[model samples]
Structures are given as structure tokens and as C-alpha cells.
Target: MILTAIVQTKAGTLVVDLPRDRIDLEMKIRSVGIERLSDQIHIIDDEEKSDISVKLFGESDIGRHLSLLFNENYTLFDVNKTMQFVANSVEDIRDDLEMNIIHDQYDTPAELVGDIERMTDEVGQYTETFYFPLVGNMEDDDDGEQYEVGNRYLRYYEYEIRELLQKEQDLDGTNMKDYFYDDDNAQKKMVSCQWDVVDRNNTLYGKVEFRLREPFTAEEKELVRSWCIGQAADGLGEGLEQRPIETEDGDLYVSMWNSGDDYFMYDEDEMNDYLAQQQGGVMTQ
Candidate 1:
């Protein structure tokens, strides 16, 4: 018999095939590495409060047991307690059974905390131009082969800003590393955020986003606006900025304006027309 076990990691899915024979199972299990069990931790803020979560494979019976173990052993702040509990249970099994389990080795709690703190610092420093990779799977059309795909995307600073402004807390301070690194006080602080997929020419474009912080200045806002418009133009192509160019699908243009305390986004036909005029005329059909 083959016992198939699935584990999620920050990189992607990890599938383990264990034979029913105890000897073979031990041998096979011994091959498990530390890199296959981690998951990406995301922190989201909504209305001045923080929510933390991780993208991972659904739990099984063993996973549930792990959840209990984690709660008892450590504090996984801001994460879905159930998920953390399940993960911790899995770790426990790995340890007790001498099963080969893949997980990162953070020699100390401070080391784990530092890794997360660095991530938070990165999010803050690069408030604009921050990108994350969303992992998935794809099959090759020619060979019927399968492969992992990491679709990169730009995360908008606006999302975090809205979350922090409403909640008055630092979303990044959420304790993601605690659960991920198997440490205490993991749940005392957690953060949550959301991301959307982006496409270009029917192909996945790398995720990108602008990171932002509190008390945004007018200059910063304008810079973001310009950068976004430039990105749109870059994605669409040259001459897209000046005129309403029709692609195979529909008209596309960049519209920017300011409201009482924020900025707005829309497609601008006039801007496209102006661009066309600048080009001497629209592209001939």
C-alpha cells in the first residue's frame, strides 16, 4: 500500500509517498528535508485590527492533532488557530516517529523573530514596488508534464494603508514567524493582507505592489500615481499613455485624479484621444 501525504511549503506542494512496509517507510521517511514544510505567512489589516493567515494545504487527522500541540507548546498570534494547531501536530509526529520532515531550522527564537522583522522592514521600506510570488501548478501542453508556477505580482500599498489607518496598528508586527519557526509567543501578534493575480497578454505577470506607511505625504501620493500610470503604460506599450488605444479586447487608458483626502483611478478616454492626436492619428484599422 502507498500512503500519500501532502504538505504545503512556501515554495509549493510537497507530496510524500510512503510504502506500507515499515522498513521501507522508515527509509523513505528519512529522506524528508527541511525545506518542504514551510508556508508563506500573510498579514492583513482590516478596520484598525490585524488578521494573520498562511496559504497551505488543507488539514488531515494528523494536522488536527498538530494544531492542539502547537497551541499548548507555543503562542501563534494572529494565525488561524486551527491551522497552526494542525501544523504543530504534524511537527510533533515527525519528531516522535523520527520521520523525515521538511522544515526550516531557526536555531533560536530571536533568529526566527529577526527573519520576520526583516520581512516587515522590507514591506515598510519598499512601500512601493513590493512584489510577491503566488505559487501554483501548470501542465505542459506538449509533453503532458506538470510543473510548479510562481506567478509574481505587485501588491498595492493602499490595501495595507487602509488596514492600518482603520486599525491604528502595524500589520507587519503580527507574529508570523512564531508559528512558521515553531517558537513561543507566535500568536500574540499576527497580521493579515490580501493579494490578487495579475495577467499580461494572457500570461501571468510577476506580482508587484507599492508599499505605503502612515501619514502619506502629497509628494509620495503623486509619486505613486505617476509610477502606477507609468506601469500601466509600460504594460500596455508606448503611445498607450497619450491615446485611448483599442486592443483586441477593448479601449484602455489611464485616468488619475485626487479626492478630498485620497486618489481615484479610472480609464480616461480623453487622455487616449490626446495621445492619438500627439501621434498624428489613431492606429489605422
Candidate 2:
């Protein structure tokens, strides 16, 4: 199913296409801060149609980098520009995938690439980074490739820890973005990250409740709030509805060491216990 919407503003005209069947057109209309067009927008049934006309508008330099206001502090520059950045990010993902495939072992590079593509099939927002500690002093070869013989850490063995997670995503019906990266090396532990994408599939909306651990830093508090915006972006595309929750508890935080539907809170005692359980359970490093 293809849904097309024609949008016009003081700057210019924009033609948008949603290739998904289950699309909330009303939500999308409101996302552009143009709720009045909700009723005026039209969608054509093009399932049987072989070809469709797509109108392309000329780029306007006026608001090419304009700040799209989605509530306060939840601003996006431009979708077209952002997509370019996302394209660049794909190269980075490929580079990391190549590095891991060359240094770590499991299957062919094609298989790993296919797995990554499948994992990131959705257009939702998420980012991940891999880490492997350097066990010995590193030296570059003639081809400029860094290699170490004796050290397991220098050989990029940390990625092997995620073999179970890869299987879970491939067979256990787990969401790829939700897969946790576990590492035994303390130096490599701090390099994992997963951003929560707010979608109808995961977000609790206003039902979200915060249970934060105490003695947290200001940075940790901000990180929790940042994820909220990210979750909104995942759900509402480029728009956001920032609703700050007042918590009497201490600062909120997110850790890469754990995995859950809700990742924006801290509990020192409970977290240590949860980590122990996770380590002891299925996902071990």
C-alpha cells in the first residue's frame, strides 16, 4: 500500500510518500505542525497500479536549514538534510561491520552484512557501536591493517560475545534494536550504546513511570530525558511532544550494561542484582 500526501507552505511544496500499509496519516499530518490539513489530505489506493506519478519540488534555500519546531528543545533541522546524514552514518556502520568481520569470526562477510541489514530493516532510530580492547602494543602492516597475534582482546574477540544475541535476533523473535551487547573486558564495556525508538510497538506513552537510582550526576539525568525525545521521534517520525515528569527521586540514568523496554532509569542495588541475573541467565559475556 502506498500513501501520498501533498504539502504546501510559504516556502514551497512538498510531496511525501509512505510505502507502508499501516500508516497513521493523521499523526503524520500533525507532525509537520499542520494539523489543519488532516482532513484535507487525500490517499489513493495504488496496490494494483503499476506506475504512479511522483511530484518533485525545487529546493528552497530560504528554509533549507530551518529549525523545525517540535515543542521546546525538540527541534529538527530538515528531513532532507537529516537523511543525508543518515546516509553518511550507513558508511560508518559498514566500516564497523567490515572491521568486525575481518577481526572476529562466525561466518562470511556477506552473511554478517545480511544480518545487519535485516536487523536494521526498519526506518526507526537506533545506533550501535562495537568495542574490543587492545591487549598488546599495536603496529600497522604494509596494507595499513592493524593486527596482533597473541592477544585475544587485540584480535577483536569481544564481538564473539554477541553470538548469542545474533542468534536471538535471527531465531528467537527478538527485535534487532533491542539486542544487547555484552562484553567481559572492562575497557570494552563502555563502548556499547542503543537508543530507544519510541513507537506504538514499545512506548508506554503517558503510562511511563520513572524509578531512578539516587546519587546520579546531572549528565545522567539529561541522558534519560534525551531518550524520551528519541522515543517520540521513533513513534512520531520527526515530531515530538516533550512532557517533563517531576520526580522526587534523584537523577535518572541509562546504562548500556542492561537491556529492557524502559532504559531511562537508575537503581544501584536493583541494577547490580539485575546485571547479575542477566550475566547468569542467557546473555553472558
Candidate 3:
């Protein structure tokens, strides 16, 4: 049986033919540049000039095994150096075939596998560094009204999302902004809430809830409540919703307005109920 394959290189393609009968079980198969191709496959002091050698056993399975080994070795050969080697080897092979002679390029299967694996690992690392911090917090300063609180909130949320992605083992180098802003599938899977704080007459008031995206189910609402409590605890030194009273299957909401010296937490339910009672007509339930 004769096994034939084509080796492609920058210069051109060279054909390889292996005779099953003459295959050696232990001898190494090495290639040396023919005289005419010596200029293309440069030799460094003539000692290191030949193409790599591969080993083969006389069996049907050996051809399959050898093909895999050849691919791996060629991929790892310092791609630039390997290209030159392949160009020269192909030239030599073509010359030999024209002269009715045979030639083989040899490489070990293990070496090829190792090179390919290393290249893959390097590429993966590069991708991770490029996409790790999509949205980062801005620095704060005393010269102006720095959005310190808002920046911290964004940082915390980003960290939480990163943790979730890590848990799912999906931390590929993908831009978070693209996923959140551009992709519809991502929009369906992820949720974001924005809080706008307004300063009126030296008093601060804010509203917290989902923006653009809405219909926050009970679970999502509770999650927002917990996140709000966390933010308040970190920024204001206390959890504002610790003893939230249940109203209409939701926690009793509180709105705070704080001046330089006076801070008041409004009982949102009490204010609404008082208004309802004053209007009468069964208080609108």
C-alpha cells in the first residue's frame, strides 16, 4: 500500500509518498535538503540544516497516527522558521519526484502537540486581559463634586456580575458593555437598575429602581431592595430597610431628604395612607 499526502507551504505544495512495505518500526525518518534546494532551506553550519524526522511503524494505524504528529510538529515549529523549512522541503521533494526518487520530512508527535497547546494557552490569556475590566469606577477628588457614591455603586455591581460569570465558567474575553447594550439575549438574561440622586434646596432626594427595563417581578424587586440596603449601609453607615413592613406584597418604601444638618426618612406608606384617608371613598384599598 502507498500512503500519499500533500504538504502546503508559502512557496508551493509538495507531495509525500510512504510505502507500507519498507516502513521501519524503530528507525527515525529524517529529511535532508537536496542540493538544488539548499539555498531556500538555509543550513546553519550544515549541522542543523535538515528537515525534522518522524518515526513510523508498518501498520494501517500508523498512517493515521503519523498524519496527526506531522500537523502538530509543523504548527509549533517557530511558525516563521517552519515556513522556510516547509518551503525548502517542498522544493526538494518536487525535485526528487521529478528524478523518480523518494523523500520524507520527519518530526516527533509529542513535540507538535506541545507547541500547539502553548500557542492556544497564550491566545487565551491575551483575550482575558483585553476584556476583563469593561466598566471601571472613576477616581474621586475634593476639587469638585465627585460622583464617588455613584462610581462605587457601579464598581460593586460590576464585581457582582463578574462573580456570577465566574460561577458559570463563562468569563471569556467579551465586552460587558457590548453584552449589556448591544445584545438582545444578554438583555433578557441580565438586569440593571439606575439610581438618580437629585439635590434640591440643599436637600438630597433619590429614586432607586430598574430603568428602561421594567416589570420587575417580586424576586427581582427583593433583590433590588437587598442591593439598595447594601449600598446604603456602605455609603450612609446603616441598612435603611432593616425593618421594612410588608405592604401590597412589597416592603414599605422609605424616601430620605437630607440637608447639611437635618436628615429625615419619610414613611412612604404612612404618607400615602394619610392622603387616602383624607380623600375618603373607601381609601382606594
Candidate maximizing TM-score: 2
Which pairs in model 2 have colliding backbones?
198-231, 198-235, 213-266
| Cα distance off (Å), candidate 1, residue 150 | 25
- Predicted candidate 1 versus true structure: per-residue lDDT over 1-285, tens digit per residue: 112334333334335432123333334323443221121222222213322222223244433222222221232222233232223222213352212112333333344334443444444432323221122333455574645433221122223222322222122232222322222222122121222233322222223233333323545444444544444324322322233322232332221211234222222343335335645775221
- lDDT tens readout by residue for model 2, 20-124: 111344455456565443323322223232122122222332122111111121111122222222222233255554354345432332344344554343322
Least accurate stretch of 10 residues (summed lDDT) in model 3? 126-135
TM-score of each: 0.19, 0.21, 0.20
lDDT of 3 at 249: 27
Q: Write the per-residue lDDT of candidate 3 for residues 1-285, one digit (tens) a residue.
A: 223433333344334444311112011111322222211322121223334222222234334444433332232222222222222222223343223211222355334333432333332321100000112222333342322233334333443433333322211112122223333542343322323342222222343323222234545434434444444333322333222323232332222222233322222354345436546624442
Q: Could you tell me how far off, in angstroms, the CA of residue 254 lies in candidate 3 after the best superposition?
A: 18
Better of 2 and 3 by TM-score: 2
The segments of candidate 3 whose C-alpha lies over 4 angstroms from its true place after superposition are 1-191, 199-203, 212-214, 236-285
Q: Which of the predicted structures, 1 or 2, would earn the higher TM-score when compared with the native?
A: 2
